[model samples]
Target chain A: MSPQDNQSTSVAASTTPTASESASARKVSRTEVRGRVWKQLPLLLGLVVLWGVLWGQFSWLNILTGFLVAIAVTRVLYLPPADISGRLNLWYSLVFIAHFIADVTVASFTVAFQALNPRPIPTSSVIAVQLRTRSDFVMTLDAIAMSLVPGSIVVEVDRERAILYFHTFDTTTAAAVEAMRAKVLVVEARIVRAIGSKDDLARIYETEATR
Target chain B: MILDSILDILTGVFLLLGGFLSVAAGVGLIRFPDAIARLHATTKPQILGLAFILLAIALQERQVSTILLLIFLLIFQMITAPVSAHMIARAGYRGGIIAPRSLLVDELEQAIDAAPEFDDTERASE
Candidate 1:
């Protein structure tokens, strides 16, 4: 674990920072810059709301102070802001949430039962799935959601290619592996439908049409 | 009066379910064959178990702030859990700690094998 972790960090340290630096270095028009900052507004507001929630109060004074604090933190502890797709389909979001909850519940029990079963230990696999959307945000959300649902854990991410390699547990057959890969695509599609950019939506639809 | 008992019963059921899942998680850690398998064992059931427990807490307290805090905690857990799991799995895979015999297929290994190695000069630039 130690050697591998060191290698992982070395690889991560080498590859990731350069990409981020290049992104920040890229030239953008004034409106694009403004839009980027505008995209951060929700995050700032969410921070303010989180502060109020933490204090268990929403007083005007609290809100004002929270706003100031949010400003301070965002500046002092800077992180790249997410470019959220402004289009959020409420119906699809609800459906995604519903399906996610169901997956978590069902998968948890299945793993539990498998763990306690007397049968021979099932074999697992590491499979990579190419994502339709190149959006980092959607990829991350999909990874997080997939990880929590059980049976799959994200092992490595190829950011440039929009590929996620997942370690799938207790899948013994090629068919099962294929099934899991298909399931990952379905999950990604649901996420894209909910809040993906127009480009992402078109990419997903194009693939679906071709399929 | 009846509603109170029903809520109490619901709380008990959720708590019991959470406890069962936690126990299963513990059993899985010991029972699974390899590192990745153990990772799945611990992550999946523990999250659902924690969710159940949080649900029980929300049911019992029935306060706006408490529920809010509970949601925050769960969200924090959900966000962090996968990150740590990914880190561990990535390291373990790189470390060669996971036994190759245990896996039915290892697509990542093939990809890793096929990719060209980075030279020291390239790494030194960063």
Candidate 2:
């Protein structure tokens, strides 16, 4: 084994047990606690808005109740601090939404046509797509987007290689499989551009363009 | 008057198409051979059907509050549906309920064999 590898392993072995034990009972400095709450502010606001919508009233009374409910829920639920890069490109977000809407419409028609067709169902495949993005947010977004479209659903996610195993309908050829893989990468690029850090956005697009 | 009639007709079309797609999804669920195909039936059309229904509702009730609620319903459904499907697919895969013949690629099986975390779960199923 390499010297660096041995050193890292030793460090891991030494810290793991104590680190895990402290994870649950760890005390935060006041400044760190305040920082966490500040980071969660957007989430709290979003919950309040959701509460108002659920009640079908955006009136002052509803807003007040929603705020109280949101605070109560946040306090009870131990939510980790959000890792928001806070780099949002409005243009990219709009484009992504437009693309998503188009995909949804296309998917609806495709599935509907397949369901209503007189011919026998073609064989489907469980295809492995190796994704480029390793970020948890990107992977989750891709999974949700692909799964919601109907012709495919993510059966397994191998986080190590960032591969998604999809149960896909009517993928008969290697070319088709590659096309699906490309489409996912394209979607990831769009997502990274929309909300990811500027460096992430540039790197994804740059790498995708090269491919 | 003409505009109102046109809106009504559009609403009717949306609702009709939505209902048709939903029925098609139901048929797919029954006719599809295995677990994965059945999941495709459950998720795809249902969200669009719900969207169409919400559109119809929004058209009928032009109140801002009602529209907001409908929009929220759509957003929540879009978020929750895929998550539930993922969970079910994972369970079905781990439990070995999904047929081998039905699967074309078995990368996940290979992944589990390589990964240590799934060892206990995979063995327990056996």
Candidate 3:
């Protein structure tokens, strides 16, 4: 008998009560694997290059250790199933990085200036920030980035209301709070466009602008 | 005297930059209107700032173990920062935080709609 037929027959024998042959015929296909691999090639290539660079200095034993470490890292940092969005363009990602770099530099100077000043830092307050992006990943990345900066922390989130309570060291007035919110929203919108579904972005624009 | 002065100056420079970045991130967190924007400000500077501080320490002490530990700490922070950010963002979404103006779409709404409803009683308790 042919290998294909033999394998099919074994698969059939494993399940008897139901019509296993027909089910097997429909279940797995070679074409599906090829399509998945085709879609994932870029991601795979990136991973391989990254791994090689990170492990380049290691000996064979050290390579093995690194491999284990990589695996552990993956397990610990396993992200939620990404909502694959057709709209995520490479250009958007580049722009997001560029904008982020600018923000970082600006913020660094702002904080340093504050530190140099002798006046007592103003009393802090939690400002409620409303978001527009619908993608969980983009929003989360933004929040994390905000929390890492100086003089502020994300204290609480009212997800239902789509509002974030941000603790600030210098909460002077409602206008100041609003200005901060606007800046964050603009960046979040850019990030969402970079990494989120086009449909998601549309909804956000529609809801936020109209409201 | 000159060499020692140079080393002291270098250390001071690193400390200043690191401290500035850390404070900037904190201020951005408080100042930025939304979580995502705040996160953008926070992650990059915090990593850069901490790296600077650690480098200064390594230079000052010039010890092998301290350097190794510093390297380990930097790696740990780099990995954890993004992962934690991802998690909190996801949780924020499941919890229902809306994006601000400028976003153009809403794929999450579809997912939330498609998701099967649990007992209303459970939701109310939350």
Residues A1-211 of candidate 1: C-alpha lDDT, one tens digit per residue? 2322323322133223334454764687899878877888888887888898899988999999999999899777666566588889999999999999999999999999888888877998999999999787898899889999899999888766788999999789999999999999999999999999999999999999999
Clashing pairs in 1: A4-B95
Which ranges in model 2 have alpha carbons more than 4 Å from their true place?
Answer: A1-35, B113-126
**Where does candidate 2 clash, by residue pair?**
none
Could you tell me which 10 consecutive residues in candidate 3 chain B have the lowest summed lDDT?
A: B98-107
In TM-score terms, which candidate is top? Answer: 1
- CA deviation > 4 Å runs, candidate 3: A1-47, A57-80, A158-161, A207-211, B1-46, B51-126
Which structure is stronger by DockQ: 1 or 2? 1
Alpha-carbon runs more than 4 Å astray in model 1: A1-33, B118-126
Residue B38 lDDT in model 1?
Answer: 93
Model 2, A1-211: lDDT tens digits are 3322221211111122333434853687889778777877888898988888777668999889988999999777655454566677999899988999889888887877777787777566667777666565677787788888767787766655678787777666767766777777788888888887666677787786886
Q: For model 2, how does the per-residue alpha-carbon lDDT over B1-126 read when each residue is reduced to its tens digit?
A: 997888899899989988988998888887777777778776888899889988988887888878877887888899889878877776676677778776555666676668776566435433
Arranged by DockQ with the best first, the candidates are 1, 2, 3
The 10 consecutive residues of candidate 1 chain B with the worst lDDT sum are B117-126
Count of backbone clashes for each model?
Answer: 1, 0, 45
What DockQ does each prediction reach against the true complex?
Answer: 0.59, 0.42, 0.11
Candidate 3 lDDT tens digits, A1-211: 3323222211121123234544553565799647544544444444443454454443566556655655566446543223345456789899987877677556656655554455644444445567865554565566655655444455444444455555454546666666667767777777777877777688768867886
Ranking by lDDT: 1, 2, 3
RMSD of 2: 6.5
> DockQ winner among the candidates?
1
